[model samples]
Target: LVVRLPLYIHLIHSHIHTFSFSYILGPMLSYFNFALVSASINIFFFIAFLFQPESPYYYLMRNDVDNASKALSWLLKADEDETDKELELMRKSVEEDRQKKAGWKDLVATPTDRKALLIRFLIGFVRQFCGIIPISCYSTQTLKAAGDSFIISPDNCTIIMGIMMVI
Candidate 1:
């Protein structure tokens, strides 16, 4: 998990940059160019996913043993015998999960559990009323309105805000 910290950060950074650059381009480029650029990213990901194997669990859940075995073999890079053993283990795990039952009463089963649940609810309630989403959505327009008082352009300020989020 520690080794993947950079990967997580890179994912966040790329997403922020994508949104910031697209927003900046919307005003500067032709409407078609802006749309093409935005759509191209999604198209690339769609094509890439087309070649990837489906989740073995998806096939297993549908009782499709043959496809599940094939997917598991490809994903695990294992031979037939090893794949069969792993598949059996997976089947047992799924069966056990299906046998278990959960209910709303489980949320407050213990004092510690109840405390944690209450804290989570409070945090979510506070977050919803915090106005962060609204603020972020209107930030560019707000910056543009106050741009006359600043040295930098509103577009540059937007990029700065995106970088700050990445940090």
Candidate 2:
């Protein structure tokens, strides 16, 4: 929910600025304003990220259980007993992950791995045939082509598409 909400809001803001500037301020100025808005959002996101607590996983990976406990406790609002149990579980999971240590060779080593690889490749190949990328790339133009069919303006249609993608 946290991730989705921010993405939705960002897309909505982007669509609004895109339509407003291109319609009212002209195409050339809109490009400049788009750059300005992008930079501003990036700066804001960076500043906001700085205030977030370091992930408990980071400390756990470094074998700093004390700091991991502290961070996890703060994040989860859990009691010390609960924190200890969670920390132990995380430690075991991390150790197991490190022990597995699979290399690129393992990708084709077994039937299961081969099947997984084939499935992944097939999915990627199929995805390229989907018109989503082209449609997204030329969304404004695509909407403008159907300008008469939509009750709202093409600009609003594009904005709604952006919102829907985020959702």
Which 10-residue span in candidate 2 carries the lowest summed lDDT?
A: 20-29
Candidate 2: Cα lDDT at 51: 87
Which parts of model 2 are misplaced by more than 4 Å? 1-29, 115-135, 139-152, 156-167
Query: How close is every model to the real structure, measured as TM-score?
Result: 0.63, 0.59
Tens digits of per-residue lDDT, candidate 2, 49-70, equal: 8987766777888988888888
For each predicted model, how many residue pairs clash, with residues at least 3 apart or on different chains?
0, 0
Q: Give RMSD (Å) of candidate 2 vs. truth.
A: 6.8
Q: Least lDDT summed over 10 consecutive residues: which range in candidate 1?
A: 1-10
Among the numbered candidates, top lDDT falls to 1
Q: Positional deviation of 21 in candidate 1, in angstroms?
A: 7.3
- lDDT tens string, model 1, 50-143? 9988777777777888998998898878789989998897778667767878789988999999999999999889868988657665676888
lDDT of 2: 0.72
Q: How many pairs of residues in model 2 come into backbone collision? A: 0
Model 1 alpha-carbon drift over 4 Å, by segment: 1-53, 163-167
